[model samples]
Every structure is written in structure tokens, then in C-alpha cells.
Target: MIQNEIIETIETIETICSRRSVRKYTADSVSDEAVLTMLECARFAPSGLNNQPWRFIVVDDREIGRRLSELTHYSDIVASAPLLIAVFLDTDASYNRDKDLMAIGASIQNILLSAHSLGLGAVWLGEILKNKESVSKILNAPGSFELTAVVAVGHLDESDPGTAERKALDEIVFKNKY
Candidate 1:
């Protein structure tokens, strides 16, 4: 007899539905285990030629977080969160530069969904991209690594911003050709 029985699981669609961008956060801290778990999800994301050129800087230090907050438009949110994760792309390791970037985007999506499923509030701030050179220096990123985004993570506050409206499928999808 086969010993391994399949376990029932929550629908991924439901998790997708529940995912939202949370800007405000509570004082509660996100555990290191939680951060690792989210990154593990990101680790599984597909990459071109399996380069997997994603690098991350997890900043739990309040001073560093404050500095990062100051550098981004979402200053209040970044400063308030218990943690900040700086996502990076390795330009030199990429098999195909442009395709590699799309892989990094997949990794980011994994982090966001993983955060939501774990009951943590998180937000992705692209403001850092505008000052990538300076921000990369601040983070001490390797020459091959390019800073892409910064994600703030913490406990969800009472005032949830709720889900923003999204365009209907019909509005975005096109058959065969555009």
C-alpha cells in the first residue's frame, strides 16, 4: 500500500484573491523564520538558463530601515515596518539580461504572495530604482548586482487599505495577437 496520502490544501486562487498592498503596519516584528520562508518561495521562481541571479538584503536594523525609508517616496511606511528587503539582480550572471529581469519580477511576486499568506503586511517600493546607484552603494551591493526594489514587511495594522480595483480580464487579454 502507498503510505503517502495527499493532504488537502487551501486554494491558491483564494490566496491570490486575498493578496493586497499594505502600507501601514503595526509595531509587531516579523520573525526571522517568516522572512526565510518567504525567500524560500522566491528561490523557487523560474530564471533564464536557471541563472537564478537574485540577491537580497534583509534589513532588520532600525537605523538602516530609517535610512532606506528616507530614500524612498514611501518613507513613512518603510520607517514604520519592522523589516526591509532589498531585491537585486545580478547583471553579470544573467544568460539573457532582459529575460533575467522578468525572472526577478517573478521572485518579487512570490515574496508578496508569501507575505500575504503568512499574515504579514508588505509593500514594494520602486522609488529606490530612481536612485539605484546611490541606494546600491548604501546597501553595499556587489558590482554585478543591481538594486531593483525594496519591500517593507511587518504586522498588519487595524486599518487595512483593502484591495485596489483591478482592470477586468477582457480589458487586458487579447486573442492570438493584439
Candidate 2:
């Protein structure tokens, strides 16, 4: 049991460390199963008071993708990726606004990590939030749903986007108090 636990821990850390924001992808499409799998991982993300406010709209239609792409500066990736998952916060289901938003962020992170593990490249397009209303309208999402993020996923065309540089723990983390 201890040996299995160690392996699982290593695998989890490996996945987290190696995941990257893939902006470029191939023309090939992402399978429905793969998309569902990512969402499955997302749904498991922790939420405050067990109120899961995260909702997803899978945008596989090229026309719709193009429309959404125009709403953000990351238009090239959004318009070109074979799949886009629009993450939303169901306001009606939320308890505390701040906590629910954090939960939604966790959910989006899960989607990104899951995509990496599945050998699919995914990019979380938060820049689109500037036109959140436009995105919501284009997707036909209900008024109660607030657009949180739009993640573009597809078969990777370019080489692995290795991890970016990060600040040392001492620079960002404190022992007891800052």
C-alpha cells in the first residue's frame, strides 16, 4: 500500500509540474470522450459548502469558436483549436461569491491538468473575460451563468511547451509571517 501511495504521489506531482499552456495545436479534432474525461476531472474539484457552481459549454463548432475567438486577443488559438470548453459559474448555485469563484478556478485547473495527462494540449483563455457578456450571449448561456474561462484543447502540433521560469520559494513563500 505504501509503495502504491508513493507512486501515485509521484505521478500527481509529475503531472502538475509538467503541465503547460499550449497555444498551438494541430488541425485534428479532440474526441468527445477526451472532452468528457476532462470535465469529469473538473467536476471533482472541491467547492465551498459542496455547492458546485462550475458549468461547462463544449464548443466544437468552428463557426461558434470563431465568434468566441473574436472576443479575445488570443483569437488565433481560440479560433483554431479543435475544441473549446467554456467554463461558467452558475450564480444560482453559488453560496459565497468569492469562495465559489476560487472553486471555479480549481475546476479550470483540473481541466487543464487533465488535458495534459490525456496527451491533449489545452490553454485556459482568461483574456476573453473582458468580453464576458459577448461570450455568454454567443454560447446562449443562461443569465444565471457567469462566464469564467474558455479553455482551448486540441492535438498538439508544436513541440512540448516546457515549463516557464518561476520565482524561488523564499521569494514568494514565508515561514510564518511576511
Candidate 3:
């Protein structure tokens, strides 16, 4: 029999393992409490020199979320999600953009993992930054930060079968020097 702690950890793994993109959500509104909690989880992600260049902007306003959804081609599945967070890399934040982007990716992962643990679903959408002008005006992003990714979140409307397929272990793994 598994110890209680191990069982709990197993459950978390199961939740993460079966997680899937959920673009459809009920009419439920995401509370500020949930949003804060998710950001709190993101706060601890590793950053170069602990600079923590990632900034999370919450879009709860249906109009604003809709605007961003349309601007980024976030899709109905993503648009229907209750909340969206714009993850930014504060390039002028005493770090280079490349390092900031890596940190921002970690921060985004934190948000997604937290959502999965909470029975919510999140999808990481990239490159909306290519339309920087629109997204900047939409979110009113600060000059110091460059929008890198967006995360849409909500309670999943249906079941999650499993993770996407992975390359065979042998295909990716390498020994000593590869």
C-alpha cells in the first residue's frame, strides 16, 4: 500500500499526466482568489540571478479577453476559457530578452501545473507577440515588458484521455556525449 503522501503525489501526477487543452467553459466566473493563487505559484519559478522577469497580467473582463482572443487567434476553445494571463518577459528588467524568455517559460509552466492541480485546464499559446502592437494596446503592457506567451484557463468541460504521444525513449535519449 502507498503511504498517504505518496498517494497524494501520485494523484497529482495523474492529474498532470492526463491534462489536455480545454477551450470550452461554463458561464462560471473565475474568482480573483483563484487568479492570485495561480500567480503565487508562478512566483517561485527559477530565474537568472533570481531576477524574476516574468509578469503575469490577468484579463477577466469578457470584452478584453474577447479582444485578445480575436487578436491572437486564440480560438473558441481558448476564448471560452474563463481567464487569460499574458505572460511577459521584462527585457529591460536588468536581464536580456533571451534569459527573460526562458524564465517566462518556467513561470508559464508553473501556472499551468497549478491549474491542472486545481482541476482546471490551461493551454500555453505562443507568438501572439508577433502582433505586438495589438496585444500591447489590448493589455496596456508596460514598455519594459514584451509579451511572450498567453495562457487561457478554466475548468475543463470534459474528460482528459491522456498526454500527447512522445517519441520513443530510445529516439530522444543519448549517452555520455550523444
For all candidates in order, the CA lDDT equals 0.85, 0.92, 0.77
What does candidate 1's lDDT look like per residue over 1-178, in tens digits?
2333222134576777778889888888899899999999998999988889889988888888887777777789888989889999888887787888899989998999899989898888897788888778877889988998888888899697756799877788877353
**Which of the two, 1 or 2, has more lDDT?**
2
Off by over 4 Å in 1: 1-10, 176-178
Model 3 bad stretches (over 4 Å):
1-12, 159-163, 176-178
Using lDDT as the measure, what is the rank order of every candidate, best first? 2, 1, 3
- Cα TM-score per model: 0.90, 0.95, 0.85
Which of candidates 2 and 3 is the stronger one according to lDDT? 2
RMSD to the hidden true structure, all candidates = 3.2, 1.9, 3.1
Backbone clash tally for model 3? 1
Highest lDDT scorer: 2
lDDT of 2 by residue, 98-129 (tens): 99999999999999999999998988888999
How do the residues 1-178 of candidate 3 rate in per-residue lDDT, one tens digit apiece? 5699899999888866776656566668777788888899999998889999888788877888777777765557446777889888776775666777788888888898888777777788775667867887888888877788889887776654424777776788877354
For residue 88, give model 3's deviation from the true position in Å: 0.5
What CA RMSD would candidate 2 show? 1.9
What ordering of candidates by TM-score runs from best to worst? 2, 1, 3
Clashes of each: 0, 0, 1
CA lDDT, candidate 2, residue 37: 94
